[model samples]
Each structure stands twice: as C-alpha cells, then as structure tokens.
Target chain A: MFSGAQVSLYPMTDDFVGVILKAITALEPYRPDFRIETDDVSTLLVGPPDQLFPAMRDLFVTAAGSGVHCVLAATVSRGCPGEPDDPICTPINDVHYGQPLEERIAAAIQQVEAAPKTGQIVAAQFSLYPLGSGHHMDEIYGCIEFLKNSGVFDRSKNFCTKLRGDAGAVFATLSEAFLRFGAPQGHVALDLKVSANSPTAV
Target chain B: MFSGAQVSLYPMTDDFVGVILKAITALEPYRPDFRIETDDVSTLLVGPPDQLFPAMRDLFVTAAGSGVHCVLAATVSRGCPGEPDDPICTPINDVHYGQPLEERIAAAIQQVEAAPKTGQIVAAQFSLYPLGSGHHMDEIYGCIEFLKNSGVFDRSKNFCTKLRGDAGAVFATLSEAFLRFGAPQGHVALDLKVSANSPTAV
Candidate 1:
C-alpha cells in the first residue's frame, strides 16, 4: 500500500515567513525517515504512516509553540495503487541521511533571515484519500473515536478542531491518534486543514 | 449577531435525491425560525444558534437513519457585521411556521418519487466561521474539548472526524457541539456541508 500526505502550514504572526521557516526547520530531524518536498503551496511527505504521522505531530507542535495561531492543512492517503513507485516513495535504508539537526536549523534560519515579516492568520484546507480499503468506513469511525478521546477536536464547526496550550500534551494526543489510524489493520486515509491565529472564519 | 450555516449533504445511495429531500423536509418544522434556502450546490440556514443547531441535528439524524454512508459539510458563522439584514437572517416570531411534520415528509417524498437507487459511501468537507467574538479562540478551544469528551472526533487526520453507525448518537454529539458554539455568550457563526452515500474520499 502507498501511504503519504501533503501538508501546508500557516503561522499567524507578523513574522509569518520566519515562523514558517522555523517550522520547516523543526522537521529537519525526521527528513531522513520520509521524502519531504516543499513548494509554494505545500510540503509533501511520502513515507509509511509510522514516520509521516509523528513528523506531522512534531511540526505542528513546534509551530503552535510559538504562541501564534497556526493552521495546517493536509491530505493523507493509503492503499493507492495508482501512485507512482519513485525514489521519493521508496523507503530509505540510511541510518544517517542528512546533516546534524542543529546545522539544518542554522541553515534554515540563515536562508530566511532576509525575508520580510507580516502578521496574518494562517488559513488552510486539505483533503485525504484512503482508497481501496474494504473497511474504510470502520477505519474512519475508529479514527474519529480516537480524536474525540484526544481532547483537541472542535465539534462545533464540522471537522475543524482547535489545539491550544500545553503543546506537549497536544502533540502527544495528535501523534497517538495518527499512529493508530495508520496501523495496517485500520486501512485508513485522511484529509484535513487547520487555521491557527486566524482572524476570520476559514 | 447574525448567525448562519451553509450545508451540503451527500447520501452514498443511488436514491440520493430522495434522501436529501427527506432530510430537508425534516427541517420544515423549524422553517419559520430559520431562513432556509436551497440551490443546486447547497442549503443555507440562518438563525440564532439555539434553534439552528438542533434543527440541523434532527435533519442529519433523520438522513443518517437510512443506514447509508452520509457526509455533511458545513460552514457556520456568527457576528458578521457585513452580512445583510435580509428576511432569511431575520428571526421569525410566528407561533406556527409550516405544515405538520408528516405532511412535510410526504410532500418531500412525493417530489423525489422518481429518483433511482444504489448504495455507496458518502464523503464531504466543510468550514465554520465563528467570527467577532472576543473569546472566539477560547470558544473554539472549548468546543474542541467538548467534542473530545463526546467521543466522535478523529484525531488522526487533523480535525476531520467520522460519523458512522448509530445515527442517534452521531447526531446528538454533532448537535451538542454546534449548539454550544452557537451559544449566545460565545457570539459564534458557522458554515458547513454534508454528504451521505458517497463512495469516495471527499
């Protein structure tokens, strides 16, 4: 089965460019575990759910820790027979695939040091495709149950949830649910978007 | 504050038209209290959250009772100073609004008597905007906590949660959160869409 996700992050701050750079830097440690690609619209991560979900949790936690509203939009998929089997999709065997985490962070900071700053709420939307699972509905149900138990879901506005305060707890809850849903047995796929520090409805 | 939501419903069965009509008819009783309009793409409901949330709950619960996969996408909003003060946004004072529930259902069924039939999974997406609240973030956070306690949220895929099996419970959880967010104190607004009986990821 092919499993992967595309994610976009928006930090609600005057220094949104810097904040976004910081978030990308936060994921430097896990770059070796997954194929990470960044474009103007989003960052795409291709890997097994085990690596992808945790990396996502870390990224969100780090971004949210800045005390600015941030919205993350992502679409996750598994069991995609149509997806290509490219180098990016292939698993990495290297135990050490990149530079040290500190070095990566330093490089990222240096790269964005000259960027302009603006304070704006980040609004994003995503869709996930968990295709070809006979028990797709069941997996969705299970995943929802997990989120309800995680204490981060905002039920008032459809599937959009809010994560605030105590970043450690928020990350733990989010990662746990992601890992469980990515389990082989569930055969789940997900799509999502979150807006943090948004001044208006996203 | 002007509060409203836009919803789209998809039923995973071939009898989608009938199912949708049935759901709409279910809300006839509250028509006077809410300004409800239906176009090709979606149905819009505007009113106080107190009345609007419960009405939506009943409609979704009735639709989900068919044992077919359904997805609802909605965007909810409150405190929109820019929204026009149209009749739809106006609160109704009528003691008697529309026909009795049975008559409305019968009418809806008759209108869709020629629809076809099939079974599939429903997929949908939605966004909610609870604007102009000093505690907007806090209210969102509170609503998320409420959903986490309610046991219907799926934490694995950001805010995307699933609703399956036991239509009653699903509706209850959904309505409760909507109502809480729509509470007068929170000054919230909402928008949404729903799909039932769809077969693919939405």
Candidate 2:
C-alpha cells in the first residue's frame, strides 16, 4: 500500500530560516529509503510506512535541538484509494493487517514498546480518518482504546487526541494509530500537529 | 445540531504575544452568539454554525492587517455522536441537508458567492471527515467539486485541498464544505489550516 506525509516545520525565532533549513537535512539519510519532495507549502515524503515515522522524528528532533519553540504540521495518509500506488512504498506486508480488532491493538502496543528512544520529548495531537467505510466509528473507537494503553496517551480533545512522551514513542504511537485501526489497503489519513519546546504552559 | 471549533492562531513574528492578544479582540462581538474559552493551546468557539465562519474571518483579518505572517489552525466539527450537544450551539438546521450531492454542491457554491469580502487575502487547506458512512468518499468527492467552483479554490495538494482568495470567500468555502458534506446527524470533522501574509513563498 502507498503511504506518505506532507510535513512543514515552523521555528518560533527570527532565525527560523536557518533552523528550518538545517533541520530538513535530517531527512537526507532516509532519501534512499523514500521519495522526498519539497514545495512551498510542505515537504512530501513518500515511501514505506515503517520508515516514515523515523524520518519525521529525526527532522523534528533536529529542529527542536535548536532550543527554540518549534512546531511541525503533517498530513499523513496510507492506502488512499484515490491516489495511485508507488513502487517505492510497496512490497511490504503487515502481518497483523487482517487480525481481529483486539489482536491488532495488542500488536500495536507491542510495536510502541519496542520503539527506540529518541530522548527528545514532544507533544502531539492527531485526528485520524478511516474514510469510505461503514465501520469507521468502530475503528476510531478501537484506536482510542489502543492509544489509552500506548503509554503516551495524554488526553482527548474536541477534535483530536493528544500524546506526549519521548519522540520515539510518540511517533510510534502515531504510526500504529494510522496503520492499525483503519482498514488496510483502504483510504486513511491523519491530521497531525506536534510541538517541542513550546513556550505556553501545557 | 451541535457544532464547535478549536482554533489556534500562530503569528510568525517576534511579537507573537501582542498579535495574538490584539487579534482575539475581534471575537468579542461574536461572544454573545457563541460560548468561547481560551486556553494555552487554543480557543474553543461553540455556537450556531452559520456564524462560525464570520467570527473566524474577523479574527484572521485583524491579525493579517498587522502585516505580519499568520496562520490559523482549526479543528471544526458538528453532530458528533460521542459529544453531548450544547444548547449554545443548537437550533441550526441546514436547509440543504439530506439533499442530493449535486444540489448540495450547488448550494454551497451559492453561499460562497454571497460571502463578504474581508479584503485580507488568505490561503487555506482542510481535510473533511464524514465518518462511519460507506458513501464518505462520495461526499468528499462531491465537496471537491463544490470547492473547485467556490471562487477560492486553489490547487489540491497531496493530503488536503487548498483554497486562496479573500478571507471571506475562503472561510465561507470552509463553512459550506463542513455543513454541506457528510451526514447532518452523524459525526463530521474538518482539520483546517489557513495562512495570511505568509512570508515564505506559497
């Protein structure tokens, strides 16, 4: 299934231009593993689903490392029916794709537990969409349940769920939510916003 | 039906605090029409759906008038089954609800045509979720058709659709897209991000 994200980073400083440019270089190592394109609005990273979070994590960690308030906005999707599949994002199979809801939740939790620690702490909120499906609510509810047990779950807001923890685990939780709950090979997306070193009291 | 939005404004300037505080004053007039609250992360606005866009438009216009880069992030929703209905946001009846998709698209276009031009130019991108319905994509595709004719339609990006025009038409387009698509009584959501005077090349 095809999967990708359009990501933009904002640094809250007069030196924003330098911070943003320097941070994007973190995606360089992942270039061979994915197809990355940058435009005026955002950077599009397309390729395998598993490599996606790590790439984003590095980009964010690098930017946040500047010790200035920073925010990253990302729109992530997988298996969108309307979008054509790309060979670079293919050949990968999810063993738990067709598992029962309970089983999938269990598998997702295990994935998060094994995620490598990136050390940087961050807060994130995301609204997931499992589109064109009759049982979308069930999937969303199940995702909520999984998130609560993911150790990074913070709280549920009006339009999205919040999470906070090490960047590694936080990104892992997001990855599982986007992949596990929605119908595999169907249209699904996540409207993700993340902040690191935010000045506001949280 | 219940409707509300969680909105966060980001002013891309060193004096962000001043810009945000000054822009918030624009919401005062709409306070009588909606229940409003501000926290560290965002401002919560709940009220009649029709008035939502106007309130947001004024806020954006005020901030953009400062001639600094600004971005507004809003998560808007209506008729969510999981959320309790608030009386403050009640009594809204969309006349076009339950109509054929084509008719709804035409109605939405009409609404945009009558929108008041705010003179502030803006660009926005939003993803609408009409959850748990088998025809969700049909509604989404229908919305796409409406946006193309909305007078604010920009180009469609990878994860969300973009719009650019006077703040009035852009915001009106967003309101119509939310109210006109999806099941009126079922859960629906929009992840909206709008930019005004963005210093970066758009």
Off by over 4 Å in 2: A91-95, B91-94
Across A1-202, the per-residue lDDT of candidate 2 in tens digits comes to: 6789988787766677788889988988988878887765677888988777788899999999998877788888888767788888863544457778999999999999999998889988888888878777789899999999999999898777889989999999998888888887788888888888877747
Question: Largest TM-score belongs to which candidate?
Answer: 2
Interface RMSD values, listed in order for every candidate: 19.0, 1.8
Q: Please write out the lDDT profile of model 1 over residues B36-107, one tens digit for every residue.
A: 766433456877554665576667767766766554555555544345444454434221214433343333
- Give the poorly placed runs of model 1, Cα more than 4 Å off: A84-130, A133-135, A151-165, A182-187, A194-202, B1-202
> Model 1, range A37-136, lDDT digits (tens) per residue?
6543346788755466557666876676676656565656554433444444443422121443334333333322332222322322222222233333
**Model 2, residue pairs in steric clash:** none
Error of 2 at B92 (Å): 5.6
The per-model lDDT (C-alpha) reads 0.47, 0.84
Q: What share of the true interface contacts does candidate 1 keep?
A: 0.00
Judge the docking of candidate 2 as incorrect, acceptable, medium or high: medium
**TM-score on B-chain, cand. 2:** 0.95
Which 10 residues in a row give candidate 2 chain A its minimum summed lDDT?
A90-99
